[model samples]
Target: MTLVRVSRGVRMHREAEPDLAAHVRPLTRISGSCAASHDTAARLWNFPEPERRPFDRRIHISRPSGGARMQRPGVVGHRSRLLPDEVAYVDGLCVTTRTRTWLDLAEALEIDDLVVIADYLLRIPRPEFEGRAEPYATREELLAMLRRHPGKRGLLKAREALALARLGADSPPETRLRLAMLSAGLPEPEVNKPIRNDDGDTLHAPDLSLPEYRIAIEYEGESHGNADQIVRDIEREERARAADWDEVRISKRHMANGARRAVEKIAVALRARGWRQEDAA
Candidate 1:
Protein backbone atom coordinates (compact mmCIF):
# COMPACT_ATOMS: atom_id res chain seq x y z
CA MET A 1 0.00 0.00 0.00
CA THR A 2 1.54 3.30 -1.06
CA LEU A 3 1.35 6.11 1.52
CA VAL A 4 1.44 9.84 0.73
CA ARG A 5 3.22 12.07 3.23
CA VAL A 6 0.88 14.91 4.18
CA SER A 7 2.94 16.66 6.82
CA ARG A 8 6.11 15.86 8.78
CA GLY A 9 5.63 12.40 10.26
CA VAL A 10 2.03 12.31 9.03
CA ARG A 11 0.97 10.02 6.19
CA MET A 12 -2.18 8.74 4.58
CA HIS A 13 -3.13 6.10 2.04
CA ARG A 14 -2.19 7.20 -1.50
CA GLU A 15 -5.71 6.51 -2.78
CA ALA A 16 -7.44 8.31 0.08
CA GLU A 17 -9.03 11.64 -0.62
CA PRO A 18 -7.23 14.57 1.01
CA ASP A 19 -8.74 17.75 2.35
CA LEU A 20 -7.88 20.75 4.53
CA ALA A 21 -9.19 18.98 7.62
CA ALA A 22 -6.94 16.02 6.96
CA HIS A 23 -3.92 18.35 6.82
CA VAL A 24 -4.87 20.59 9.76
CA ARG A 25 -5.93 17.86 12.22
CA PRO A 26 -2.49 16.26 12.42
CA LEU A 27 -0.71 19.59 12.94
CA THR A 28 -3.05 20.70 15.70
CA ARG A 29 -2.59 17.33 17.42
CA ILE A 30 1.14 17.98 17.64
CA SER A 31 0.41 20.11 20.70
CA GLY A 32 -2.74 20.40 22.77
CA SER A 33 -2.39 24.18 22.98
CA CYS A 34 -1.66 24.74 19.31
CA ALA A 35 -4.51 25.75 17.00
CA ALA A 36 -4.94 26.62 13.36
CA SER A 37 -4.80 30.36 12.71
CA HIS A 38 -4.24 33.13 10.14
CA ASP A 39 -5.10 32.09 6.61
CA THR A 40 -5.64 28.55 7.74
CA ALA A 41 -8.32 29.55 10.20
CA ALA A 42 -9.89 31.95 7.69
CA ARG A 43 -10.26 29.12 5.23
CA LEU A 44 -11.90 26.89 7.85
CA TRP A 45 -14.37 29.64 8.61
CA ASN A 46 -15.15 30.08 4.90
CA PHE A 47 -14.08 33.72 4.84
CA PRO A 48 -13.48 35.35 1.49
CA GLU A 49 -10.12 36.89 0.65
CA PRO A 50 -8.97 39.05 -2.22
CA GLU A 51 -7.35 37.44 -5.27
CA ARG A 52 -3.73 36.50 -4.74
CA ARG A 53 -1.16 33.97 -5.84
CA PRO A 54 -1.82 30.27 -5.77
CA PHE A 55 -3.23 28.89 -2.55
CA ASP A 56 -0.69 28.20 0.20
CA ARG A 57 -0.46 24.66 1.51
CA ARG A 58 1.42 25.45 4.70
CA ILE A 59 -0.37 25.08 8.01
CA HIS A 60 -0.44 28.12 10.31
CA ILE A 61 -0.61 27.32 14.00
CA SER A 62 -0.55 29.53 17.07
CA ARG A 63 -0.28 29.09 20.81
CA PRO A 64 -0.34 31.36 23.85
CA SER A 65 2.49 33.87 24.31
CA GLY A 66 4.63 31.84 26.75
CA GLY A 67 5.36 28.93 24.42
CA ALA A 68 7.97 28.98 21.68
CA ARG A 69 6.49 29.18 18.20
CA MET A 70 5.93 25.79 16.59
CA GLN A 71 8.61 25.29 13.94
CA ARG A 72 8.52 22.55 11.35
CA PRO A 73 8.49 21.99 7.61
CA GLY A 74 5.18 22.87 5.89
CA VAL A 75 4.18 24.99 8.88
CA VAL A 76 4.19 28.74 9.60
CA GLY A 77 3.73 29.20 13.33
CA HIS A 78 2.92 32.29 15.35
CA ARG A 79 2.96 33.09 19.07
CA SER A 80 0.44 35.55 20.43
CA ARG A 81 -1.46 36.42 23.58
CA LEU A 82 -4.51 34.33 22.83
CA LEU A 83 -7.13 34.73 25.49
CA PRO A 84 -9.41 31.77 26.11
CA ASP A 85 -12.39 33.63 24.70
CA GLU A 86 -10.38 34.59 21.64
CA VAL A 87 -10.29 31.00 20.45
CA ALA A 88 -13.08 28.79 19.16
CA TYR A 89 -13.62 25.37 17.68
CA VAL A 90 -14.68 24.82 14.11
CA ASP A 91 -15.35 21.38 12.64
CA GLY A 92 -13.69 19.76 15.68
CA LEU A 93 -10.42 21.70 15.20
CA CYS A 94 -9.44 24.59 17.47
CA VAL A 95 -9.14 27.96 15.73
CA THR A 96 -9.09 31.64 16.48
CA THR A 97 -12.37 33.48 16.97
CA ARG A 98 -13.78 35.12 13.86
CA THR A 99 -13.07 38.65 15.11
CA ARG A 100 -9.57 37.79 16.33
CA THR A 101 -8.80 36.24 12.98
CA TRP A 102 -9.84 39.50 11.41
CA LEU A 103 -7.50 41.40 13.72
CA ASP A 104 -4.66 39.05 12.95
CA LEU A 105 -5.18 39.58 9.22
CA ALA A 106 -5.03 43.37 9.52
CA GLU A 107 -1.23 43.21 9.40
CA ALA A 108 -1.27 41.44 6.07
CA LEU A 109 -4.43 42.66 4.27
CA GLU A 110 -5.07 46.10 2.85
CA ILE A 111 -7.64 48.30 4.64
CA ASP A 112 -10.20 47.67 1.92
CA ASP A 113 -9.58 43.95 2.04
CA LEU A 114 -9.96 43.97 5.79
CA VAL A 115 -13.20 45.88 5.34
CA VAL A 116 -14.29 43.17 2.96
CA ILE A 117 -13.92 40.59 5.70
CA ALA A 118 -15.53 42.90 8.21
CA ASP A 119 -18.52 43.48 5.96
CA TYR A 120 -18.86 39.74 5.55
CA LEU A 121 -18.92 39.18 9.28
CA LEU A 122 -21.45 41.96 9.74
CA ARG A 123 -23.83 40.72 7.07
CA ILE A 124 -26.99 39.23 8.55
CA PRO A 125 -27.21 35.56 7.74
CA ARG A 126 -30.42 34.04 6.46
CA PRO A 127 -31.22 31.19 8.78
CA GLU A 128 -33.26 29.24 6.27
CA PHE A 129 -30.54 29.17 3.67
CA GLU A 130 -27.33 29.60 5.68
CA GLY A 131 -28.20 27.54 8.77
CA ARG A 132 -27.59 30.53 11.04
CA ALA A 133 -29.80 33.45 12.08
CA GLU A 134 -27.30 36.04 13.24
CA PRO A 135 -24.26 37.63 11.68
CA TYR A 136 -20.89 35.97 12.24
CA ALA A 137 -19.86 38.89 14.41
CA THR A 138 -21.21 42.25 15.42
CA ARG A 139 -19.61 45.68 15.11
CA GLU A 140 -19.75 46.11 18.87
CA GLU A 141 -18.04 42.77 19.38
CA LEU A 142 -15.27 43.83 16.99
CA LEU A 143 -14.82 47.16 18.80
CA ALA A 144 -14.58 45.41 22.14
CA MET A 145 -12.00 42.99 20.82
CA LEU A 146 -9.96 45.89 19.50
CA ARG A 147 -10.11 47.59 22.89
CA ARG A 148 -8.71 44.43 24.44
CA HIS A 149 -5.81 44.22 21.99
CA PRO A 150 -4.61 47.80 21.71
CA GLY A 151 -0.97 48.39 20.74
CA LYS A 152 -0.91 45.23 18.64
CA ARG A 153 0.92 45.26 15.29
CA GLY A 154 -2.14 45.93 13.12
CA LEU A 155 -4.33 47.75 15.61
CA LEU A 156 -4.27 50.98 13.66
CA LYS A 157 -5.20 49.34 10.40
CA ALA A 158 -7.90 47.25 12.06
CA ARG A 159 -9.44 50.32 13.61
CA GLU A 160 -9.42 52.08 10.26
CA ALA A 161 -11.07 49.09 8.64
CA LEU A 162 -13.72 48.97 11.34
CA ALA A 163 -14.54 52.63 10.81
CA LEU A 164 -15.07 52.03 7.11
CA ALA A 165 -16.88 48.72 7.49
CA ARG A 166 -20.63 48.85 7.01
CA LEU A 167 -23.39 46.26 7.27
CA GLY A 168 -25.33 44.83 4.28
CA ALA A 169 -22.32 44.35 1.98
CA ASP A 170 -22.88 40.83 0.64
CA SER A 171 -19.59 40.23 -1.18
CA PRO A 172 -16.00 41.46 -1.49
CA PRO A 173 -16.80 43.07 -4.82
CA GLU A 174 -19.70 45.02 -3.31
CA THR A 175 -17.53 46.34 -0.50
CA ARG A 176 -14.75 47.21 -2.94
CA LEU A 177 -17.17 49.02 -5.19
CA ARG A 178 -18.52 51.08 -2.30
CA LEU A 179 -15.00 51.94 -1.13
CA ALA A 180 -13.96 52.94 -4.63
CA MET A 181 -16.91 55.27 -4.92
CA LEU A 182 -16.15 56.87 -1.55
CA SER A 183 -12.48 57.32 -2.47
CA ALA A 184 -13.55 58.94 -5.71
CA GLY A 185 -15.65 61.56 -3.86
CA LEU A 186 -18.94 59.95 -4.85
CA PRO A 187 -21.68 59.98 -2.27
CA GLU A 188 -21.81 56.75 -0.34
CA PRO A 189 -24.42 54.43 -1.85
CA GLU A 190 -26.88 52.52 0.27
CA VAL A 191 -26.18 48.79 0.38
CA ASN A 192 -28.90 46.31 -0.59
CA LYS A 193 -31.96 48.45 -0.02
CA PRO A 194 -35.15 46.97 -1.43
CA ILE A 195 -36.84 48.85 -4.25
CA ARG A 196 -40.61 48.57 -4.06
CA ASN A 197 -43.19 48.92 -6.81
CA ASP A 198 -46.24 51.25 -6.92
CA ASP A 199 -48.21 48.83 -4.75
CA GLY A 200 -45.39 49.04 -2.15
CA ASP A 201 -44.21 45.50 -2.89
CA THR A 202 -40.49 44.89 -3.16
CA LEU A 203 -39.41 45.01 -6.80
CA HIS A 204 -35.66 44.52 -6.65
CA ALA A 205 -32.90 44.95 -4.14
CA PRO A 206 -29.80 46.51 -5.63
CA ASP A 207 -26.32 45.68 -4.45
CA LEU A 208 -25.72 49.40 -4.01
CA SER A 209 -28.38 52.03 -4.42
CA LEU A 210 -29.07 55.76 -4.38
CA PRO A 211 -32.83 55.53 -3.96
CA GLU A 212 -33.18 59.26 -3.54
CA TYR A 213 -31.75 59.66 -7.04
CA ARG A 214 -33.80 56.71 -8.34
CA ILE A 215 -30.66 54.83 -9.39
CA ALA A 216 -29.69 51.23 -8.63
CA ILE A 217 -26.29 49.61 -9.06
CA GLU A 218 -25.41 45.92 -9.25
CA TYR A 219 -22.03 44.16 -9.38
CA GLU A 220 -22.28 41.32 -11.89
CA GLY A 221 -20.01 38.50 -10.89
CA GLU A 222 -19.02 35.70 -13.26
CA SER A 223 -22.15 33.79 -12.28
CA HIS A 224 -24.14 36.40 -14.16
CA GLY A 225 -22.76 34.91 -17.36
CA ASN A 226 -24.96 31.86 -16.92
CA ALA A 227 -27.79 31.76 -19.45
CA ASP A 228 -30.43 31.39 -16.74
CA GLN A 229 -28.87 34.18 -14.68
CA ILE A 230 -28.82 36.42 -17.75
CA VAL A 231 -32.55 35.89 -18.26
CA ARG A 232 -33.24 36.63 -14.59
CA ASP A 233 -31.07 39.77 -14.79
CA ILE A 234 -33.04 41.01 -17.81
CA GLU A 235 -36.32 40.51 -15.95
CA ARG A 236 -34.88 42.36 -12.92
CA GLU A 237 -33.81 45.30 -15.10
CA GLU A 238 -37.24 45.37 -16.70
CA ARG A 239 -38.89 45.55 -13.27
CA ALA A 240 -36.56 48.40 -12.26
CA ARG A 241 -37.44 50.29 -15.44
CA ALA A 242 -41.16 49.86 -14.80
CA ALA A 243 -40.56 51.31 -11.34
CA ASP A 244 -38.89 54.37 -12.93
CA TRP A 245 -35.41 53.51 -11.62
CA ASP A 246 -32.24 53.66 -13.74
CA GLU A 247 -29.95 50.70 -13.25
CA VAL A 248 -26.17 50.50 -13.65
CA ARG A 249 -24.71 47.06 -14.18
CA ILE A 250 -21.04 46.51 -13.31
CA SER A 251 -18.75 43.58 -13.96
CA LYS A 252 -15.28 42.51 -12.85
CA ARG A 253 -13.68 44.29 -15.82
CA HIS A 254 -15.32 47.57 -14.88
CA MET A 255 -13.86 47.26 -11.36
CA ALA A 256 -10.31 47.45 -12.75
CA ASN A 257 -7.96 50.39 -12.24
CA GLY A 258 -9.39 51.45 -8.90
CA ALA A 259 -12.93 50.96 -10.21
CA ARG A 260 -12.57 54.14 -12.26
CA ARG A 261 -14.71 52.80 -15.07
CA ALA A 262 -17.31 51.42 -12.66
CA VAL A 263 -17.60 54.76 -10.87
CA GLU A 264 -17.90 56.58 -14.19
CA LYS A 265 -20.82 54.38 -15.12
CA ILE A 266 -22.55 54.99 -11.78
CA ALA A 267 -21.78 58.73 -11.92
CA VAL A 268 -23.35 59.00 -15.32
CA ALA A 269 -26.45 57.20 -14.11
CA LEU A 270 -26.66 59.50 -11.11
CA ARG A 271 -26.14 62.62 -13.21
CA ALA A 272 -28.93 61.69 -15.56
CA ARG A 273 -31.20 61.09 -12.58
CA GLY A 274 -30.70 64.63 -11.22
CA TRP A 275 -27.46 64.15 -9.29
CA ARG A 276 -24.61 66.63 -9.74
CA GLN A 277 -20.84 66.37 -9.22
CA GLU A 278 -20.93 69.39 -6.91
CA ASP A 279 -23.75 67.81 -4.89
CA ALA A 280 -21.29 65.30 -3.55
CA ALA A 281 -18.98 68.11 -2.49
Candidate 2:
Protein backbone atom coordinates (compact mmCIF):
# COMPACT_ATOMS: atom_id res chain seq x y z
CA MET A 1 0.00 0.00 0.00
CA THR A 2 1.16 3.53 -0.83
CA LEU A 3 1.70 5.83 2.13
CA VAL A 4 1.74 9.61 2.55
CA ARG A 5 3.39 11.47 5.42
CA VAL A 6 0.89 14.06 6.71
CA SER A 7 3.44 15.29 9.24
CA ARG A 8 6.77 14.13 10.64
CA GLY A 9 4.95 11.95 13.18
CA VAL A 10 1.84 11.07 11.15
CA ARG A 11 1.55 8.79 8.13
CA MET A 12 -1.49 7.68 6.13
CA HIS A 13 -2.42 5.02 3.61
CA ARG A 14 -3.07 6.47 0.14
CA GLU A 15 -6.10 4.20 -0.20
CA ALA A 16 -9.30 4.71 1.81
CA GLU A 17 -9.35 1.22 3.31
CA PRO A 18 -8.89 2.01 6.97
CA ASP A 19 -10.70 4.23 9.46
CA LEU A 20 -9.13 7.70 9.24
CA ALA A 21 -9.64 8.35 12.94
CA ALA A 22 -7.18 5.58 13.74
CA HIS A 23 -4.35 7.56 12.14
CA VAL A 24 -4.52 10.49 14.58
CA ARG A 25 -5.40 8.51 17.66
CA PRO A 26 -3.07 9.48 20.49
CA LEU A 27 -1.34 7.28 23.03
CA THR A 28 -1.61 9.47 26.11
CA ARG A 29 -1.66 9.10 29.90
CA ILE A 30 -2.29 11.87 32.48
CA SER A 31 -0.84 11.49 35.93
CA GLY A 32 -3.69 12.93 38.03
CA SER A 33 -6.28 15.16 36.29
CA CYS A 34 -5.78 15.69 32.55
CA ALA A 35 -7.94 15.68 29.45
CA ALA A 36 -7.74 16.20 25.72
CA SER A 37 -8.21 19.84 24.76
CA HIS A 38 -8.31 22.24 21.78
CA ASP A 39 -8.45 20.91 18.25
CA THR A 40 -7.92 17.31 19.30
CA ALA A 41 -10.97 17.50 21.55
CA ALA A 42 -12.83 19.32 18.78
CA ARG A 43 -12.30 16.34 16.52
CA LEU A 44 -13.63 14.08 19.26
CA TRP A 45 -16.70 16.27 19.79
CA ASN A 46 -17.37 16.48 16.02
CA PHE A 47 -17.14 20.26 15.81
CA PRO A 48 -17.00 21.76 12.34
CA GLU A 49 -13.71 23.62 11.90
CA PRO A 50 -12.91 26.30 9.33
CA GLU A 51 -12.06 24.97 5.89
CA ARG A 52 -8.66 26.64 5.72
CA ARG A 53 -7.37 25.33 9.02
CA PRO A 54 -5.63 22.01 8.86
CA PHE A 55 -5.93 19.12 11.30
CA ASP A 56 -2.78 18.87 13.36
CA ARG A 57 -1.66 15.36 14.10
CA ARG A 58 -0.17 16.33 17.45
CA ILE A 59 -2.55 15.35 20.25
CA HIS A 60 -3.42 18.20 22.65
CA ILE A 61 -4.04 17.21 26.27
CA SER A 62 -4.71 19.65 29.12
CA ARG A 63 -3.96 19.38 32.79
CA PRO A 64 -5.79 21.20 35.56
CA SER A 65 -2.72 22.00 37.70
CA GLY A 66 -2.30 18.73 39.67
CA GLY A 67 -1.25 16.24 37.02
CA ALA A 68 2.30 15.03 36.56
CA ARG A 69 4.01 16.10 33.31
CA MET A 70 3.37 12.83 31.59
CA GLN A 71 4.82 12.68 28.07
CA ARG A 72 4.24 10.45 25.08
CA PRO A 73 4.97 10.36 21.36
CA GLY A 74 2.85 12.79 19.28
CA VAL A 75 1.44 14.56 22.33
CA VAL A 76 1.28 18.29 23.04
CA GLY A 77 0.41 19.27 26.59
CA HIS A 78 -1.34 22.29 28.10
CA ARG A 79 -1.81 23.39 31.68
CA SER A 80 -4.61 25.60 32.97
CA ARG A 81 -6.14 26.07 36.38
CA LEU A 82 -9.59 24.96 35.35
CA LEU A 83 -12.59 25.02 37.64
CA PRO A 84 -14.35 21.79 38.60
CA ASP A 85 -17.07 22.41 36.01
CA GLU A 86 -14.65 22.59 33.07
CA VAL A 87 -13.85 18.89 32.70
CA ALA A 88 -15.88 16.05 31.22
CA TYR A 89 -15.44 12.46 30.11
CA VAL A 90 -16.44 10.98 26.77
CA ASP A 91 -15.83 7.54 25.34
CA GLY A 92 -13.64 6.84 28.41
CA LEU A 93 -11.29 9.76 27.73
CA CYS A 94 -11.16 12.80 30.01
CA VAL A 95 -11.72 15.99 28.00
CA THR A 96 -12.45 19.64 28.44
CA THR A 97 -16.16 20.46 28.46
CA ARG A 98 -17.60 22.00 25.29
CA THR A 99 -17.82 25.52 26.70
CA ARG A 100 -14.32 25.21 28.05
CA THR A 101 -13.12 24.20 24.64
CA TRP A 102 -14.74 27.32 23.22
CA LEU A 103 -12.96 29.46 25.79
CA ASP A 104 -9.65 27.77 25.06
CA LEU A 105 -9.99 28.44 21.34
CA ALA A 106 -10.28 32.17 21.97
CA GLU A 107 -6.48 32.23 22.28
CA ALA A 108 -6.14 31.01 18.71
CA LEU A 109 -9.21 31.95 16.64
CA GLU A 110 -10.22 35.08 14.77
CA ILE A 111 -13.50 36.91 15.20
CA ASP A 112 -15.05 35.16 12.19
CA ASP A 113 -13.68 31.80 13.25
CA LEU A 114 -15.15 32.14 16.72
CA VAL A 115 -18.50 33.23 15.31
CA VAL A 116 -18.69 30.18 13.07
CA ILE A 117 -18.02 27.89 16.04
CA ALA A 118 -20.52 29.74 18.20
CA ASP A 119 -23.24 29.54 15.53
CA TYR A 120 -22.66 25.81 15.28
CA LEU A 121 -22.76 25.26 19.04
CA LEU A 122 -26.02 27.17 19.45
CA ARG A 123 -27.98 25.93 16.44
CA ILE A 124 -31.70 25.68 17.19
CA PRO A 125 -33.86 22.64 16.41
CA ARG A 126 -30.90 20.37 15.72
CA PRO A 127 -32.47 17.47 13.84
CA GLU A 128 -29.09 15.82 13.38
CA PHE A 129 -28.60 15.36 17.14
CA GLU A 130 -30.36 12.35 18.66
CA GLY A 131 -32.55 12.41 21.83
CA ARG A 132 -33.30 16.18 21.68
CA ALA A 133 -30.36 17.24 23.85
CA GLU A 134 -29.12 20.84 23.62
CA PRO A 135 -27.00 21.06 20.49
CA TYR A 136 -23.74 22.32 22.11
CA ALA A 137 -24.03 25.01 24.73
CA THR A 138 -26.28 28.06 25.27
CA ARG A 139 -25.43 31.69 24.57
CA GLU A 140 -25.46 32.49 28.26
CA GLU A 141 -23.18 29.57 28.95
CA LEU A 142 -20.73 30.84 26.37
CA LEU A 143 -20.90 34.33 27.88
CA ALA A 144 -20.14 32.99 31.31
CA MET A 145 -17.16 31.13 29.94
CA LEU A 146 -15.90 34.37 28.45
CA ARG A 147 -16.50 36.14 31.73
CA ARG A 148 -14.32 33.56 33.47
CA HIS A 149 -11.51 34.45 31.10
CA PRO A 150 -11.79 38.23 31.30
CA GLY A 151 -8.21 39.16 30.56
CA LYS A 152 -7.51 36.60 27.86
CA ARG A 153 -5.59 37.70 24.77
CA GLY A 154 -8.35 37.37 22.20
CA LEU A 155 -11.13 38.60 24.47
CA LEU A 156 -12.07 41.54 22.24
CA LYS A 157 -12.40 39.44 19.11
CA ALA A 158 -14.21 36.75 21.06
CA ARG A 159 -16.57 39.34 22.52
CA GLU A 160 -17.28 40.78 19.06
CA ALA A 161 -17.95 37.32 17.67
CA LEU A 162 -20.07 36.40 20.70
CA ALA A 163 -22.35 39.37 20.05
CA LEU A 164 -22.86 38.24 16.44
CA ALA A 165 -23.47 34.55 17.16
CA ARG A 166 -27.06 33.49 16.54
CA LEU A 167 -29.13 30.31 16.51
CA GLY A 168 -30.57 28.75 13.29
CA ALA A 169 -27.43 29.06 11.15
CA ASP A 170 -27.10 25.54 9.80
CA SER A 171 -23.77 25.91 8.00
CA PRO A 172 -20.57 27.94 7.91
CA PRO A 173 -21.53 29.67 4.68
CA GLU A 174 -24.86 30.76 6.13
CA THR A 175 -23.13 32.19 9.20
CA ARG A 176 -20.61 34.03 7.01
CA LEU A 177 -23.46 35.46 4.93
CA ARG A 178 -25.11 36.84 8.04
CA LEU A 179 -21.85 38.52 9.11
CA ALA A 180 -21.36 39.96 5.62
CA MET A 181 -24.84 41.49 5.58
CA LEU A 182 -24.42 42.99 9.02
CA SER A 183 -20.97 44.36 8.15
CA ALA A 184 -22.45 45.93 5.01
CA GLY A 185 -24.94 47.84 7.22
CA LEU A 186 -28.01 45.81 6.34
CA PRO A 187 -30.47 45.00 9.08
CA GLU A 188 -29.78 41.68 10.77
CA PRO A 189 -31.83 38.99 9.03
CA GLU A 190 -33.41 36.03 10.78
CA VAL A 191 -31.79 32.66 10.09
CA ASN A 192 -33.52 29.60 8.61
CA LYS A 193 -36.99 31.12 8.45
CA PRO A 194 -39.80 28.69 7.63
CA ILE A 195 -42.60 29.36 5.21
CA ARG A 196 -45.90 27.68 4.41
CA ASN A 197 -48.01 27.70 1.26
CA ASP A 198 -51.61 28.86 1.24
CA ASP A 199 -52.55 25.17 1.23
CA GLY A 200 -50.31 24.66 4.33
CA ASP A 201 -47.49 22.90 2.48
CA THR A 202 -44.32 23.86 4.27
CA LEU A 203 -41.35 25.15 2.29
CA HIS A 204 -39.72 24.65 5.71
CA ALA A 205 -37.09 27.44 5.58
CA PRO A 206 -34.53 29.49 3.69
CA ASP A 207 -30.96 30.14 4.89
CA LEU A 208 -31.84 33.63 6.00
CA SER A 209 -34.93 35.83 5.89
CA LEU A 210 -36.41 39.26 6.55
CA PRO A 211 -40.02 38.62 7.45
CA GLU A 212 -41.19 42.24 7.20
CA TYR A 213 -39.82 42.55 3.64
CA ARG A 214 -40.70 38.99 2.59
CA ILE A 215 -37.12 38.35 1.52
CA ALA A 216 -35.36 34.99 1.66
CA ILE A 217 -31.59 34.50 1.26
CA GLU A 218 -30.30 31.07 0.34
CA TYR A 219 -26.69 29.91 0.02
CA GLU A 220 -26.48 26.93 -2.31
CA GLY A 221 -23.50 24.63 -1.96
CA GLU A 222 -22.29 22.21 -4.65
CA SER A 223 -24.88 19.60 -3.65
CA HIS A 224 -27.63 22.07 -4.42
CA GLY A 225 -26.64 21.95 -8.07
CA ASN A 226 -27.21 18.20 -8.23
CA ALA A 227 -29.99 17.36 -10.66
CA ASP A 228 -32.47 16.21 -8.01
CA GLN A 229 -31.78 19.10 -5.63
CA ILE A 230 -31.86 21.53 -8.54
CA VAL A 231 -35.36 20.41 -9.42
CA ARG A 232 -36.49 20.72 -5.83
CA ASP A 233 -34.80 24.13 -5.43
CA ILE A 234 -36.46 25.43 -8.56
CA GLU A 235 -39.84 24.33 -7.28
CA ARG A 236 -39.15 25.99 -3.93
CA GLU A 237 -38.07 29.28 -5.48
CA GLU A 238 -41.03 29.35 -7.85
CA ARG A 239 -43.42 28.62 -5.03
CA ALA A 240 -41.79 31.20 -2.77
CA ARG A 241 -42.16 33.84 -5.48
CA ALA A 242 -45.77 32.87 -6.12
CA ALA A 243 -46.38 33.53 -2.46
CA ASP A 244 -44.91 37.07 -2.90
CA TRP A 245 -41.60 36.27 -1.18
CA ASP A 246 -38.39 37.28 -2.97
CA GLU A 247 -35.72 34.58 -2.99
CA VAL A 248 -32.03 35.50 -3.26
CA ARG A 249 -29.89 32.50 -4.14
CA ILE A 250 -26.12 32.63 -3.51
CA SER A 251 -23.42 30.22 -4.60
CA LYS A 252 -19.66 29.90 -4.06
CA ARG A 253 -18.94 32.47 -6.72
CA HIS A 254 -21.21 35.03 -5.09
CA MET A 255 -19.16 34.69 -1.89
CA ALA A 256 -16.32 36.55 -3.65
CA ASN A 257 -15.42 40.23 -3.30
CA GLY A 258 -16.26 39.95 0.36
CA ALA A 259 -19.75 38.79 -0.59
CA ARG A 260 -20.26 42.18 -2.22
CA ARG A 261 -22.26 40.78 -5.11
CA ALA A 262 -24.51 38.71 -2.88
CA VAL A 263 -25.08 41.67 -0.57
CA GLU A 264 -25.83 43.92 -3.55
CA LYS A 265 -28.37 41.49 -4.98
CA ILE A 266 -30.10 41.15 -1.62
CA ALA A 267 -30.14 44.93 -1.16
CA VAL A 268 -31.75 45.40 -4.54
CA ALA A 269 -34.32 42.70 -3.83
CA LEU A 270 -35.11 44.32 -0.50
CA ARG A 271 -35.56 47.72 -2.18
CA ALA A 272 -37.99 46.25 -4.69
CA ARG A 273 -39.95 44.79 -1.78
CA GLY A 274 -40.33 48.20 0.00
CA TRP A 275 -37.04 48.56 1.91
CA ARG A 276 -35.56 52.06 1.77
CA GLN A 277 -31.85 52.14 0.89
CA GLU A 278 -31.47 55.24 3.06
CA ASP A 279 -32.51 53.19 6.04
CA ALA A 280 -29.29 51.24 5.60
CA ALA A 281 -27.39 54.46 4.93
Error of 2 at 21 (Å): 6.4
Q: Model 2 over residues 238-277: C-alpha lDDT tens digits?
A: 9898887889999989888778988998989988888886
lDDT per residue for candidate 1 within 1-281, as digits (tens), equals 79988777778889988688777877887778988888888887788865542224578899889899988887888998899998887677888989999898876777887898999999998788889899999999999989998799899999999999999988889999999999988889999989887789898789999878888899999899999999999999999999888989999999888889999999888878888888878
Q: Which regions of candidate 1 fall more than 4 Å away from where they truly are?
A: 1-6, 52-56, 197-201
* Among all candidates shown, the one with the greatest TM-score: 1
Pairs in clash, predicted candidate 1 = none
Off by over 4 Å in 2: 1-27, 51-57, 65-74, 125-133, 196-203, 274-277
Per-candidate RMSD, Å: 2.2, 4.6
Q: What is the C-alpha lDDT of each candidate?
A: 0.87, 0.77
